[model samples]
Target: MLTFDIENFPGYPQGIGGPEMMVQLREQAERFGLEVHDKNVEKVDVSNRPFSKSGLKEKNISLRP
Candidate 1:
């Protein structure tokens, strides 16, 4: 699994929407033979060392400290 911690630039400051930025990122990733998963995170569990996040599409991702 690959994750990108991109900077979120709000509004059209540079003539790009938030979703459009994600789309561009996905496209760029695909150009490099990377598979992108379009998932919107709905829940996050950061109470412990190993954090877990779940997406609205039923994807459960984990992060270890």
Candidate 2:
């Protein structure tokens, strides 16, 4: 599990704890069917390959090195 210290975020006058903030964020994202992964993406290839939905050039991506 990844943890973050969110003392700098707004709405917490006294600064919210790290674990608590992570839990709240995770729950909110879950409500929208978002899946969070803990793996580190070590590499990315951004070479021009295809056009995106907006008709702009985009790159094919590969996460692993």
Candidate 3:
């Protein structure tokens, strides 16, 4: 587990803890309609795939979009 001090973050006069800071950041992102998909990306193959109206073809971009 990685950890760090968040003394410079806003709304934490006494300096928020590392985990607490992460939670706060997540909440803020959610509030702003940011999609957060927690998953591990394995591979990506952009060849001979279908393309949308923009003509962008991607075979297998193994990410959470």
Maximum-TM-score candidate? 3
lDDT tens digits, residues 1-65, model 3? 15677677578888877987788889998998876656444444445354211213423333222
* Predicted candidate 2 versus true structure: per-residue lDDT over 1-65, tens digit per residue: 25455556688877877888878889998898776655444444445434212212443333321
At residue 37, give the lDDT of candidate 1: 56
Model 1: per-residue lDDT, tens digit, 1-65?
13334345555454555566777778887898775555787888999868998887586777654
What is the Cα-based lDDT of residue 16 in candidate 1?
54
Off by over 4 Å in 1: 1-38
The CA lDDT at 15 in model 2 is 84
Order of all candidates by TM-score, from best down to worst?
A: 3, 2, 1
Write the candidate numbers in order of decreasing lDDT.
1, 3, 2
Superior by TM-score: candidate 2 or candidate 3: 3
- Cα-based TM-score, every candidate: 0.36, 0.46, 0.52
Best by lDDT: 1
Q: Score residue 27 of candidate 1 by CA lDDT.
A: 88
